[model samples]
Target: MALMITDECINCDVCEPECPNDAISMGAEIYVIDPGKCTECVGHFDEPQCIQVCPVECIPKNPEHLESPEQLMQKYHALVTAKNDA
Candidate 1:
């Protein structure tokens, strides 16, 4: 599943740089995760780097954007290919 940042995010700015997919960005209030670009770091890391560095522990699975591990891997591959093409 893709991850989301809750309102509890302190805006510490740590999570943004940690996201390899560039999914995390500053929203109107807090950091927001773009589900389209989020693959839970499956292609880059063993775990989600944003969640690892978030001090408030506010990042959680996005229920509305749930995907299986295999699906996530597919998304990861697509992202990589798109990035390479650019």
Candidate 2:
């Protein structure tokens, strides 16, 4: 599942660069995760780099966009498969 930034975030700008999918962005008051782009590091890393680097520990699973590991795998494949075919 894509990670969601909680309001507890201090906007410290730590997690933004850690995401391989470039899913994290600086919002007005907190960091935001783009669910459509977030593969939860399924195809990139063994773990979610953003969660690892976030000191605030405010990144949590996006309940609204909950997805399983296999779903994440499909998402990763769908994203790169098309580009590779190009």
Candidate 3:
């Protein structure tokens, strides 16, 4: 599943650099997670790095963008391919 940064985010700036998929970015207020680019670090780590580093514990699985492990892996591959091609 993709992870989301909740409103409770303190803009601590820790989670953005931790995202292997580059899904986290500065929103108008707090940081935001792009569900399309988030793979929950499936290919890069056993757990989501952003969640591990976020001090506020505001990151959580996005119910609106759920995916199985296999699907997340596929998305990770797709992201890798697209990045390589670019």
Candidate 4:
């Protein structure tokens, strides 16, 4: 599943640099995760790097965008293939 930043985000920006897929970006006033690009770090790390660096624990599982690990891996593979094709 992809992670999401809640309203509690302090815009600390710590999580932005930690995202392995460059999936996190700053919104007008908070950080947001791109669900299309998010693989929960399956392609890059054991855990979500953004979650690890978030100071306020604002990042959490996106209930509205849940996916199994296999699905996440599939998405990760697709991203790799797309990049390679590019």
Evaluate all candidate structures by whole-model CA lDDT and list the values in order.
0.96, 0.89, 0.93, 0.89
Candidate 3 lDDT, 40-64, residue by residue in tens: 9999999899989988899989999
- How far residue 4's Cα lies from its native spot in candidate 2, in Å, is 0.3
Whose lDDT is greatest here? 1
Predicted structure 4: lDDT = 0.89
Candidate 3 minimal-lDDT segment of 10 residues = 12-21
Clashing residue pairs found in predicted model 1: none
The collision pairs in model 3 are none
Q: Residue 62 error for model 4, in Å?
A: 0.5
Report the C-alpha lDDT of model 1 over 1-86, residue by residue, as the tens digit.
99999999999999999899999999999999999999999989999999899889999999999899999999999999999999
Local lDDT at 72 for model 3: 95
TM-score per prediction, in order, is 0.98, 0.89, 0.97, 0.93
Residue 83 C-alpha lDDT in model 1: 95
* 3 versus 4: better lDDT goes to: 3
lDDT of 2 by residue, 1-86 (tens): 88899999988888998987778898877889999989999999999998999888998899899899999999989878866797
Candidate 1 deviant stretches above 4 angstroms:
none
| Count of steric clashes across candidates, in order | 0, 0, 0, 0
CA displacement after TM-score superposition, residue 6 of candidate 4 (Å): 0.2
> Lowest summed lDDT over 10 consecutive residues: which window, candidate 2?
77-86
For model 4, residues 27-85, the per-residue Cα lDDT tens digits are 88888999989999997998888888878998889999989999999999999998889
